[model samples]
Target chain A: MQVHVEVLNFYARQMRLLDALDVEGYAGTFTEDGVTDHAHRGERVEGRAALIAGAKLALPRYAGAAVRHWNDHYLIEEVDENTLAVSYCSLVTRTDADGNVTFEPTFAIEDVLVRLDGELYTRSRTIHRDRPAAAA
Target chain B: MQVHVEVLNFYARQMRLLDALDVEGYAGTFTEDGVTDHAHRGERVEGRAALIAGAKLALPRYAGAAVRHWNDHYLIEEVDENTLAVSYCSLVTRTDADGNVTFEPTFAIEDVLVRLDGELYTRSRTIHRDRPAAAA
Candidate 1:
């Protein structure tokens, strides 16, 4: 069995937008009142605008770092006909100035996605960090 | 929408077994041939027996730590109606001997689950740690 096409596309777009630092585009992937929980950092931000603001602040930290995100694999469970619970592994890497590559960070993301008006948007995201923010 | 009862039960049993430090029981959650990728630790353990051995080697690290795991939420995706992809968030807390409690770890896990002979077992697990193990 294979993953749903829409699910794969969603992550692909997300990764592209994030790596490109398209903050607005990336934030657009969520609902207007979506929520993101960065549990490892003890951070929670709700509402699309606020999520955008948070990303705006955080994404810059990785600027010029050549960070790339890979939402490598996912498992999906249908919550209902209109909603899906999607979980997957997120692997991140960075290329150094000297062209060396190192593993930056990796974790799992548990997200709730709803199909509204025939389009899918993330309603909530909870990132489980195997590595914690405090430790960093 | 709600998570499937059986899927939820699987996690419940796995969690119960793990917190109890029941290595054999915990390993039983996996199929006879299962894969556990502790990538951050550079550990790739295969087979139920090896998984149990790995648990034996690792569980003692938390012997006196009063550790507990909470799997808060999950997203499920179905593949062929028999195999499923499940992802979830894990929050771990450790209390000291004095009863001081602090949130120590949070992470996400992505797993491949297969239904076999009217039962479900974990086939593969890939954990993404927000924090890297090398630093820990």
Candidate 2:
């Protein structure tokens, strides 16, 4: 089956916006009433305003840090015209102040994606199967 | 606008199989030519035999570990009849030998799902936004 390149590009753009901490671009990835759950803070920021505000707050804390993340072992269990459910593993890395690089453990992430207004937006997500310190 | 429950159910079953260490049920999630990257082991297991073998090896090591994984903040960027790209975050917990539980930092997972031979499987993944304990 042929995969849609547009879908891949959309996801890639979202990643780039996040990596660059582009607050505006980041907020653009969602709908007007989109919701975000920053699990680390145990907080869920809803709607575009809150999402943008949260990203603005986060950009500075990670000012000097560079991040690298990738997903492998993806299983596209099902698909339809408007929605999709996807599961995959993610590996992440962060660079510290002392120039020491660290890798976060790998984990499983499952998501439900919905097409709204001719754009792709996240509806819900579930993250599981994390093995921390795998790089340590 | 409508979400496919079967896809979610499939993901739930996959996780349940992993939690229970049910190799048979776990392996059923992949295709015959499926390949898995054992990040902890730093290797890739391809084909059904290797996939099963790798699972057998790792399941025992995680015997007593308790895990609960859920994805929230789903961004389904694009979904066609057979292909999809999704991004989401994950939270994970692990119980140690001492019975102490630790929550690893959250991670963002990006996946591309493809339909093949009447089954949906993952084609590629890119992980981003991994927050480690030090940064958290």
Q: Considering only chain B, report the TM-score of each candidate against the true chain B.
A: 0.86, 0.66
lDDT of 2 by residue, A1-136 (tens): 2223344555678778877778888777766776665454367777778878877877776767787665543455447877767666565557877877654544566666677777777665555534322211
Candidate 1 per-residue lDDT, tens place, A1-136, comes to 2237667656755665665567789888899999999887889999989987887777646644455565656789989988999998876665434434456568889999998898889999999887655854
What TM-score goes with each of the models?
Answer: 0.56, 0.51
Candidate 1: where are CA atoms >4 Å away? A1-26, A29-54, A58-115, A118-136, B1-3, B132-136
Evaluate model 2 with DockQ and give the value: 0.06
Compute the DockQ of candidate 1: 0.02
lDDT against the true structure, per candidate, is 0.74, 0.60
Residue by residue across B45-111, what tens digits does model 1's lDDT show?
A: 9999899888888876876667777663356788867799987656566777989765443455789
TM-score of predicted structure 2: 0.51
Interface RMSD, per-candidate values to 1 decimal: 11.4, 10.6
Each candidate's number of clashing pairs is 15, 27
RMSD values, in order shown: 10.8, 11.8
Q: Could you give candidate 2's per-residue lDDT for residues B39-125 as a string of tens digits? A: 433566676677778777776555555554545566665478877666667665565434344555676766666667766665544
